[model samples]
Target: MDTYAVHAEGLRKRYGGKDALAGFDLAVRRGTVQGLLGPNGAGKTTAVRILATLLRLDGGRATVAGLDVAKEPRAVRRRIGLAGQYAAVDQVLTGRQNLEMFGRLFHLDGRRARQRAAELLARFDLVDAADQGVEGYSGGMRRRLDLAASMILAPDVLFLDEPTTGLDPRGRGEVWDSVRALVADGTTVLLTTQYLDEADKLASQITVIDRGRAIADDTPDGLKSAVGGDRIEVVVGEAADIPRAWQVVAGVCREAPETDHGERRVHGLVHDRVAALTEAARRLRDEGVAVEDIGLRRPSLDDVFLRLTGHRTAEEKAGAAV
Candidate 1:
């Protein structure tokens, strides 16, 4: 068995003068969920499409299940499944009928196709909705069916692009559970999503791509450590306290400031959280400044993105028009 289900080195693709994917490199270990995170138009879709054999790479090399995407596109497709942003099911077809259609398309015989359809319907908990037309299914149901459709042939690798977009919290959790189940069965998954929490929750390794290049890549915890250790956030009583609080904190630490509503806050990276907090409190009291609240917490993936990319995902989206 191959140690890596997916591997690419210097994979490049161009659209006119712009490079959609510029010398990208990735290695997805077998049975691991690798999160591909980036802002919109960051070439995530292009990369997934190329790896799934839907598009040709302009340069470099890529292989799925050790089969070259360029020379053995059919073999690659046979071993990998793609669930795109929108569920691609035919609205007029019943859920069972949809899976049966794909199973047969994969060349399963009539008996085997029916069996596969039944297994998938039950696996996705769509047996109740099996005979109903997909047009009447909820967004979450359709998404589940779409995933089940891709697994009809039991592909070794599954590519999920924004698997839970537009889903409510419950629907998102359902999709997350399904992805976890697939990994439990030894499936290699590549998940792309705009939701940072989704990636942080699911991915064993995360690659953050920007524009057309990879800006950062690491495990969730490792990425968080890159920004700093624990964060000590101080909310002051008044905006005027910002300068004084910053002056005291800046002498011992370096961090950014964030203000919202009527609160002025500062976040500091700490080597010793307890000591840092104690000193911050003592300094504030000595200066007769009222401290509204203080907190010490772990650095989130959002902080990692800000430190590495110099912009949050939202900021990147807003700057897209430039």
Candidate 2:
């Protein structure tokens, strides 16, 4: 058997004149969670769909559980389960019925299906509400049920696309807990999320895509360090004061702001963050300028995205574009 649970090479997909996934490649090891992050139209969704066998790739090749996604899609489907951006469940059916139905569809015997349904209901903390119609379920409850449905077959691999979108903090935590449980059971997962924190908490490795291409791929810490070790954000009173500040702090700086937009910042790998901040403060005081806020912090996933892709995540970009 192939060592990887999922593998892709030169994966490509297009819509109209635009490329959705252009020459993308990926490898996810067994029993590991790999995160896909990118801006809007970055092809995260397209890649997930192709791997789940919902859409045929226009070019390249992929395999899940050692079964070719293109030539043996049915076999791939049999070993994999997908939970998409939206929750999918029978509104008219009770939560228990919904899971049981999926179990039956997976060819489980009636007694086994019932047993699996009960097991999932308790696992996801839906036992008390198990008999309620899905339509009456809250967004979080419905999402949990959708996840439960996907696991009826005890799939070797699972694909979760924006699993936590539209969920409150409690809801997000619930889903996170479910994913941890799945991983503990030795299941491999391929997850896509717009939330950087979600990737930080769940992904063993991360691949960032932008405009249908992989921009950066590594462990989360590796990507963060690649951008810069630590950041010192400096807020100054006047735009004219930025240059004077840079002069004192620029030697240790890998990148500094030449222009000010309300607030000016200097960020880079620094030998000592405290030393840099002290120099910045001393320079500003000599110039007779008031410093508002100055602090040292580690590079965030957002910072990495900004440096590599020249844009924020999908939601942030959408808000900015508006």
Top candidate (lDDT): 1
lDDT of each: 0.87, 0.86
At residue 155, candidate 1 shows an lDDT of: 90
lDDT of 2 by residue, 1-322 (tens): 4779999999999899789989998989999899998887789989999999999899999999999999999988889989998998999999999999999999999999999999999989999999999999988899999999999888999999999998988889989989999989988999999988899999999999988888888999999999767766667666676676666557546665344565575444566788877876777678776666777889888888889888877667656899
> What tens digits encode model 1's per-residue C-alpha lDDT throughout 1-322?
2788999888899999899999888889999999998877888999999999999999989989999999999989889889999899999999999999999999999999999999988888899999999999988899999999999988999999999988878888878988899999999999998788889999999998877788888999999888778867788888888888876666446555444435588766777888888888888889877788987889888777777766677534545767
TM-score of each candidate? 0.89, 0.87
lDDT of 1 at 309: 64
Question: Worst ten-residue run, lDDT, model 2?
Answer: 257-266
For candidate 2, give the lDDT of residue 62: 91
RMSD (Cα, Å) for all candidates, in order, is 3.2, 2.8
The most accurate candidate by TM-score is: 1
Cα error of candidate 1 at position 153, Å: 0.5
